[model samples]
Target: MLALNWHRPLMLLAVAMAILTLAAIGGMTIDDRTLTGLPIWTKAVKFALSVVIYSVTWAWLIAQFTRWHRIAWWAGTVAAAGLGLELTVIVIQIVRGTTSHFNFTTPLNSALWETMGLSIIVVWLATLVASLVLLRNPTSDPARNAAIRYGAGLSLVGAALGLLMVLPTQSQRDTGSAVRGAHTVGLPDGGPGLPILGWSTSGGDLRIPHFIGMHAAQLLPFVVIALELSARRIAATRPVAVRTALVKTAAAVYTAVLIVLTWQALRGQSLMHPDRLTLSAAGLVAAAATGAVIIIVRRRPPVDPATIQPTRTAPGAIR
Candidate 1:
């Protein structure tokens, strides 16, 4: 049974949206008039599902960080309201037979767009604040600490990419199209794309990096947990320091990958159409990441087991 808390409302909202998404999928077939030439409400459904997972995961994770219940409550509240409003607007616009994002069709639409954008910013700022708080109050477990730091930092990068997405693309400015702002890079909006993701298969798409970076909050911690379990399985006497170093190394490599993806998109290259130069650059990034990891691991001195505390089992805490 799920506990009743600030996060619970958001989870319920997510459930509702999920049901609506299924309904949309079942009721609405392909609509050529929509943005992506798919169902008009597809993006809203995707955003709903993403937020559902994000809200629940964030709430659970934050609870494990600090025992300050007030801060956790407020963070969860802001996340719920902000994401809820954003999704509401998107769904409303879809029902009205229009695009939700980058829509300045009328004064009302522009106002709605601005409201949605501001709401997103508010959520991002709240998340940033909470992440900083977690950093300031470090966890006893070094492995978890590394995960929290890396997750928070990468999550910020992801939010910043949201800012990038909102800005008017150079192509949009050049063409002076009615929709003067779009998420796509090399290709125009609603162009050839992959199924479901709608990522431009023919050219660059900013959403790729945005998606990858945003989920780092969830991914980094999962990696830490896995590392911890693996270490225990090997019956390593002292694993905290080693795990911390490994997490840092992984974070560095993850950031490098995000950078490479961003660079690739900015160059108007499709993800699948990477040139020789792109491949070479990626290879260099990987090599550098590996070298850094090797150096860190070598430098990591063996920690005395006597100095370390037995790992505690907190709710949602990394084992």
Candidate 2:
């Protein structure tokens, strides 16, 4: 069993986020207030849950570092603080009955939004530092190493994609709306959106790619764990090299899909209504991933007969 030395600050933040998630859920049931066509507390609940996952993941990852432990710990602390501040602002806005993001209607609102933007940038930089530390100090497990490094790198890309949402749209410029940015493309926010997530259903929703990218760290690590578990039961997946290759292939396919989704959203295409081009791109990625899996499985090393232990026989009756 692998021992984890969890970061104190990050673990505490995760606990706080868990509490906030429960509170937000309670708020959702009773408030009955709506924002952007969803319950006002909905964003709070989603953000709180996200922070819980984020903090816990960082804490565990930081604990894996053998060298530069101090740097990793400080980086995690900064990330936790930044995330806590961001969540605090979101909750404050929720209580005030206004949107937390891109709201420049008043000086206060603008200040809060700007603070969140700054906090996130800080968080991103901290994550980058921690990722560098992890890469420099890799673990003994090849599959785990690939999962951590690739997941961390891809997660940065995902977080950076959020920048696209901050640019003012043509409509916003033309109308001089108080809101400076939006999550949806080719259509206004608060339009027909997916339930719970509130991603635009009528047009392009940048949040789709952003969400996928940010969670790569969790998803990739989970893939490695699943493969590790499968190895115990499936002889073909027992080799370390095979598992690492599979993880790298999965990461590559994940990146390709993220790129496709980002492109599709930027072109103002609804996720539910992908055009032929988008569908073709996605299909190509899927086919490549499937082919890669088959090849990896086929190329796995043959199991050594010597390594197999013989079953014990009965001493008296069977003989």
Candidate 3:
């Protein structure tokens, strides 16, 4: 793990990110409506939060994949570039009136930011899955290989998408009056062109589908983390009793957090249509029911205890 130990900077970066994120949260202007997109603030916090996601995830990915530092570096770079490009899409749309400013209530611009953000999350998930697949050797062991591959692969994919970019505004502009975008700017006089650089966030709401997807990364990653933990505990167990207990414990926590995230999605809706408690309450109930179903379906199926070989064994033995 010498190759990995050489990444104190990455850990430091994560810590710094946490600090900045907290600071941003603390500094927000406290009108509940403001956060939910009711009013436009001088600096938009939600979009800023997306940047924090990229930064924090990028840092963690690098630290985890230190053994493959070079590859991790490349992926992180790409992911960051992707985030930047997404940001540019947001800014351009906001500044030039091609789309709505990251607000969910309206479907003005293409949901490119939310789309790429989720894509990055997917890349991270892919790394985790790929790592698990790679680490299945007797000598190196599946567990070990998985950890290394995920850490490195996530960081690398993150980097590539970072540098490569697509312009969303240019997209809507080409279509002209067909798009009424989040930016609130639209076709000329009656049809063919947008009011160049037009920007407005008046009455923005969170009821839209794109924002709901944005919150899933927050929920899904944690779910994956919980599942992986449950899996590891199962593999480490030599007996059914121990595996059963750990898996249950992990599932309980995972289910709870998943519900919490679903509720969060509703919070966006609340912002969009003020005083619509019926809609919001309905959402809460739905999110809870869905989370429950997911947890129930994810329970560990009965398996023979003998099937799982120990994670570590003699040199030639399966691990």
TM-scores, all candidates, are 0.86, 0.92, 0.37
Ten contiguous residues with the weakest lDDT in model 3: 188-197
Off by over 4 Å in 3: 1-38, 66-68, 82-208, 221-319
By TM-score, the candidates rank as: 2, 1, 3
Residues 201-263 of candidate 2 have per-residue lDDT tens digits of 889999999999999999999999999999999986889989999999999999999999999
lDDT (0 to 1) per candidate? 0.77, 0.92, 0.41
Q: Per-residue lDDT for 252 in model 1?
A: 86
User: How many clashing pairs does model 1 include?
Assistant: 0
Root-mean-square deviation (CA) per prediction: 8.2, 5.4, 12.6
Span of 10 residues, lowest total lDDT, candidate 2: 1-10
In order of listing, the candidates' clash counts read 0, 0, 31
lDDT of 3 by residue, 1-319 (tens): 3432433433343344455445445544443332212332223345556556545644554555435556655555554554455545544443443333333334444465466456556545544443343343222233333333333333333333332222233445566534323322221111221122112222222222233333432443453355456665545343333333433433344434334433433343222233455466556656765675455445555687999887666797864
Q: Give the Å error, residue 235, model 2.
A: 2.3
* Residue pairs whose backbone atoms clash in candidate 1: none
